[model samples]
Target chain A: MGASSPDLIVHVDTFARVNMVYEVLSVISVIMLLAASLAVLITYNWRVCVLSLAVQYLAAFWLINLDYPLAMAAVKLVVGWMVCAMLGATPVDLKQPDEQLPGRLFRLLASAMVWILVFSIAPSVLQWVPTGMVILWGGLALIGMGLLQIGMTTFAPRIVVGLLTILSGFEILYSVLESSVLVVGLLAIVNLGMALAGSYLMTVSGGLEV
Target chain B: MNAPLIWIVFPVIVSVILFFLSARRYLVVGLATGSNLFFVLLGLLLPIDRLIKLGPWAFEVSSTLMVFGRKFVITDSDAHLVVFLYFFAAFWFFGAGVVRAHRLFIPIGQCMVAIAVAAISVEPFLYAGLLIEVAVLLSVPMLVPPGRRVGQGVLRYLIFQTLALPFVLYAGWVSAGVEANPANQRLLQQGVVLLGLGFAFWLAVFPFHSWVPILVGEAQPYVSGFLLSLLQTVVLLLMLGFLDSFAWLRDFSVLSQVLQLVGTIMVASAGIMAAFQRDVARLFGQAVILESGFALLALSVPGYQGAEVFAGFFAGRLLALALWALALSNLAADGISFGFDHLKGLLHRLPLTSIAVVLSVFSIAGLPLLASFPVRLMLFDRLIPEAVNAVIWVMIGCLGMLMGGIRTMMVVAHSQEGWRFEERLPPAILMAIGLLGLVIIGIFPRWIMPYLIQLLDPFQSLGVLMILPLI
Candidate 1:
């Protein structure tokens, strides 16, 4: 083969480097998403649960950025963090130190099945939703785990976190489909409303002012 | 002048102001009632997109308002719906104090109404899911205000409603794609199925309906009645909006058959279940389900026949449900048991309220002279040829509801003690007015129903699908 020109060499090198950056980021996002959601499901510590939620949103931000600019995708990150902060600060004793060791192990085992189900269904979901592989995996994973979380708990704080996680998952999937500014704004409003509603339930059930 | 600005945005602004003024309960009630009344009048009197001159002052109310690249359109055809909504809202607000509803009732109520209107009027229509979700969230505070533990009913409501959001938005997206390529049979099926599931959750169809009685039982009857009434009505109307707008979906005859099947299940289940209910609060929930059943049945009818009955259902439902809820609220205020067994001899203590309760239930059951009877009869007449089995089950459902009503009346009227008139003035008057309204509607439906039937005019293509029940 003939020697490549200097300009062509630079162009080829830049293309490979860009692909490398994407591959690295994708792996990181996948890792963060999986670790965060599993932690949320298994942890009873409120601080750990809240931190995992924030980190899950970070994974969400990365997935969303695949479709939108960093500035636009930041809406999901900011709103998700705000929700985490709000629910985390509630006066109610959300720190449920009550579940036995078996319960945590059971949740972990159940979540394993959920992950299996997500992988099994992601191919089918892709056929209909028309999103990227990373998104399909991350979005479906979050949704499946989030639903598992909601199903496992009756406490307001956990339910709200689960709802936000599911919403963020949906946002990731939907961001790739439609780019309407208003839809993004409305979805953000929904996240905040869910958090506010959770806080209200917590404060009231914890006790007084009606 | 803009139609959306007047009907949609104005209520939101009012709600915000009312939220701050809520501590002044009387002022909030007055403002909510006045604002709703104003909306009713404006909807009835003004013609959208038409200029008129009065003493050299002229203005035209435009139909569409664009914001953030999306359109909110409220046209002349939609005026009747706006009128119906606010008119019913005013009725509820006017009775707020008598029911001793929370001070937040009016403000949060107006917010619910505004969000509901937005759900109806939002363009591209897909955005309706988010708006509806907002409306659902707003209901939380009302259902579980400060000082009360969040009931399982509220939690379930939140989860079920949240779950519906994804299905609806996803279905809308799917349908949009299918519309671009109509030959995609698999995608079409998926879209239809998703939309059907979304409606099932939103409207609380049979299997998903556990939350209905639970919610009505746990929360105050007035609040539950208002929320369920608005939620169901809007969702039904939104379903109609979908039918009117989407050709591929509506064109499928399977849609009608499915709706009929679903409607029959809801009615039969609600009615049969209502018969066994001991608590009046739960009975109210069943009553709501029964009405929803009838509305669905109306849509399942061959054509415009279903639509008229459907529209008429909306008109009759508000009066019957309002009266039923109002009567129930009045009884609740006296600290009486909602359980029929424990409520023996309540008629002697609160005769007007007891009568109101029985009459409202009787009306919902489609008794001969109730507001819903004419519509129910019309629906039966249409369903007879199409699905005799449905008619049989529906009648059974109707009879079941009527049986529940009779049981309530029996409990209310009989007592070991002597009969006494212990009802106070304000509630007695309110109950009496509702009773009269139901009677008038039952006797002369045409007078009022014509107005509500026009609610379907906004859904031009669904013109053949007039109201079995408007919200």
Candidate 2:
């Protein structure tokens, strides 16, 4: 694609053959993404949260591949899993006696609302995004839930995870729009950097060390 | 050597070396200072795509470096950016040891600068968002050293800065579409909204500025000051690039008005907020925000003059912020609270440091015979007719920040401690240099103002109004 052509840069990968298995997988990926994000929102167990986060990257990878070349797309999955490993290595202490806890049911309801909002709005928003329905639903759900997670907590770990989730969602959307190697590399760096930063924060902030 | 190699790769390599010797404060500062000085010289002496002859042997430096199918290109017009960034880095690095900043300050700060350069040189501007994100991540460790608990301020800052990424990426796509067909009102609207949101979050323009003061309150003074100054300047530079790249976006009639309004709001709100802050460090943050507002207002001026005035603010802002941060570093060395009560009558104890703090504050407030006065005047001259109400609000904002300075001064002066200068010699000398630089710039704005204004010359359309009017 010419840089200043003033023409739309169509993606070659978007022309992939539509198969039933891939279609089923895409639907499963969106569902899995929603479940993973919801799990992250309400779960107190750091282990479960990390596992849900891992599942998120997995779902993200499945959908992102629809738009990006398989090899370039797998970079996200690798980086996301690596980020999970780094965070998992860090001991996270989520329990604070002095902090007031919002009821779990309230959290569940809030997340459910986020799911409904994103899933409902996905079709309307799809007019702008040039990707498949799988990407639209999965991306919106991750963004909404990521925002909810960020808004609901001040804890360093939770905030970091939320940021990562949001980034994953954004990458899914951006992959369809951009195919620049530099953009991909820089984003991968951002993900790894954020994870390192989060671990550093946890280490310094007195979170439990594994 | 190419621009990226000279500005980006060299800095990263040096930063890695600095990391190994980071524990040795003096050595790290010395190396960083010297290397940054080298970079400034390189920026001054080296011309991209032009041959240089030194002692008979000659070599031409290329502008573009290809890596992994991507181009990191810094053209000749961008050379001044190298000059500006490193000169300030050298200035701050020179004083790092005197202030007893964290050992990681030099190494991490250098890494951030390298990442900043990468953000600047990347081929497609959209790629910059992620590079900037990495830079923000690097700041976390520098701001919060070991044993220091992370505050909501840092987290908020992280999240807020991160939030700009997606909006900017999406906007890049929309803008591409708009460029293809500028007549698509719906596409244009979508582009404008996304772009505005991206910049708003990135710049922390009004109402979204809580993180600035809060982070200032929580982090070390020098670290926060350096990061804010660097990040804000780079973001502004990026915005200029956006405007320069998109004629459609620039011609969108409301862009100027929107900028002026946002700038006015940030200035007024920050000033009012500064007046109410009990903690002096938080006030410093508001001062930073006010400066950001001023830069935005400067950019809103009718023509290339606006860009010049915008660029002209750099030297003054850098000096003032460095002075302010360095002074605060000296004043808050005891690890004591930054509350007014704790700082009561501190003037008697640290006279030079106290004076440095006040002068820096007043300078940022656009006090006469200070660094910011001339550019502020240039902005007001053109801005008033267009935005009288905004100008009035800005003056009120200026007064509020001045009031903050006055309040701080009164408290520092009222202390009961016996009159004595307790500041160490090295830090006092650094503060003196900063103060002297500010005053010198203020007294003879003509000496430096023209050079600073030249920063916009590379952007052809933006530089069309290169002839600066006499202030």
Candidate 3:
């Protein structure tokens, strides 16, 4: 499930050009990943959260494709989107009151700090992880932001999205080392199951409040 | 039939059937109990890898079943464990009926047991982490029943249990590297730390144990008891299996000392907390924490004697917990709040149940002539000379629990002025039988020691440790 040397060797110059394009795409995807994470953290609307989650999955696919084959990367992308759809279908009425400018500013500052932390540590982590620097930093950033989202909210949909983000980051890093189909399938099940549990809890919590 | 088919697949099938028939509460309970008993008998009587004639038909069971390039093996040596797990399932299912718990308890509880068995039996044991996660996921519905608000305890329990997965998987990955480069101390240390963190989360060790009381406080007493007993037993067995599988891990010199330290903290803190708890349900949680502490101490004891101590302690605690949970469930059914304020002078209205509840606490606290006493004595006798401080802390924990029991007895037995001594037929009989079983086991623990020791046979690497007489 990888590119053969003969295919690369036959058109070395062309392969190099394609690799440069892939590198640019990977960088762009990482930016989108962070943007989606920020959207989920800053917004209280479920629709906005769902849309950002979809963007996160799309960006994760491109980031994962930097190391993993397109097919393997698609497995993660599909599972992420399925989880997003499941969560979106649930009726989560986030009753969070209006946040003042100071609250928004504080959240933004916290997220920036997380980004700095990830960027600082990714260089050292890249030595051990079996992936390119771009993929590693992107995965680490997603994980850090996901953790922030989870820690900041008790609302079920946001927490579920946060969980998905964390899992996506792990999958990106794990794919670089192990490419077992069984592991991928099991992880997919975990993602879907987690989404279902989140949806159930959301409804139950809502019902109890009513 | 292969062992996996018999032990794993069959039980899973039964669970699915029970789930569909959940509306028929009695039938579901009866079927679950009957199936568990059948498996226990099968484990005891069937000879794997050897033909046995039964009424003109000859058959032999295979020990291994391969699925998707992975092997699930259950050998002759695992017979005792298989029997014990199934017997526990039967005991739990039977009590579920007596307590009239949620109808889904038997079905989901059956599945949880099967997955736990599979977790222990799975090859390349790291997969057990994922299996355990699945079991934890299955428990959510049971923990927070339908139409109920999800409590912080349930959420925290899920989060903590899920958090163990990555640690375990990473440990498995690193351990493979250690196997390749045995001299690499860095890899060894990393694997040990990761594995330790994973087990600590799984077992709910100190600082991670806040969920225990919260969970028991919110969930039904019977469900919480069943979940705690089942998960703790499996996780402890998995920890033992980890040690047995890796010689480096087992031979780590400081391992026993570390275990003793953790065990001491759990015992002391839980005991002190139990004494202060005003909520009856939370007291049950404290007892569970104390039970985990004792289990750790049992593991800390050197040689196969540790294994014997663990099995005996586990057996006694299981009985004690079942009785305690049953009594609590009956009280809850009577519309009584578990808080101290509501429990005053209730012994007159519920004489047998009150006795069972107090007796169960005393049993767990290691009072004389109760189930846990003999094992507690064995553990203390073994540890006193080697770790005197540990002995002192354990005694202090036991004393705290005894004090709590005395206070509870005094409160319940105050006897309201106009209260009548009322008792129902079924619960009275059940509580009496449970209390009687505790006493008999305390007096004749030897009846179960042979079976308990047999559970140690699967870890062939521990053969050197097994040279010591278990009793």
TM-score of chain A by itself in each prediction: 0.87, 0.86, 0.90
As a whole number from 0 to 100, the lDDT of residue A202 in candidate 2 is: 87
Candidate 2: tens digits of C-alpha lDDT, residues B251-294: 88888998899899989988888777777788889998899999
Regions of model 3 farther than 4 Å from truth? A1-24, A123-131, A207-210, B54-57, B464-470
Worst 10 residues of 1 chain A by lDDT: A91-100
Taking candidate 2, what TM-score does its chain B reach relative to the real chain B?
A: 0.97
User: Between candidates 2 and 3, which one is better according to DockQ?
Assistant: 2
Assess candidate 1 and give its lDDT. Answer: 0.86
Question: Any idea how many clashes model 2 has?
Answer: 1
Q: After superposition, how far is residue B398 of candidate 3 from its true place, in Å?
A: 2.2
lDDT of 3 by residue, B1-471 (tens): 888899999999999999999999889989999999999999988888888888989888999988667778899888888888999999889878877899879999999999988988988888788788888888888887787778878877877787777778778777777788878887788788889899888889998898998999899999999999999999998888888888888777788998999999999999988888787788999999999999999889976777778878876899889898888998888888888787788888898888888888899999988899988988998999899999999889988888778878888888646668677677678889998999998898888766677777777776633443344
Per-model TM-score on C-alpha atoms: 0.95, 0.95, 0.93
Off by over 4 Å in 1: A1-24, A95-99, A207-210, B465-471
| Stretches of candidate 2 exceeding 4 Å from the true structure | A1-21, A96-102, A208-210, B416-418, B464-466
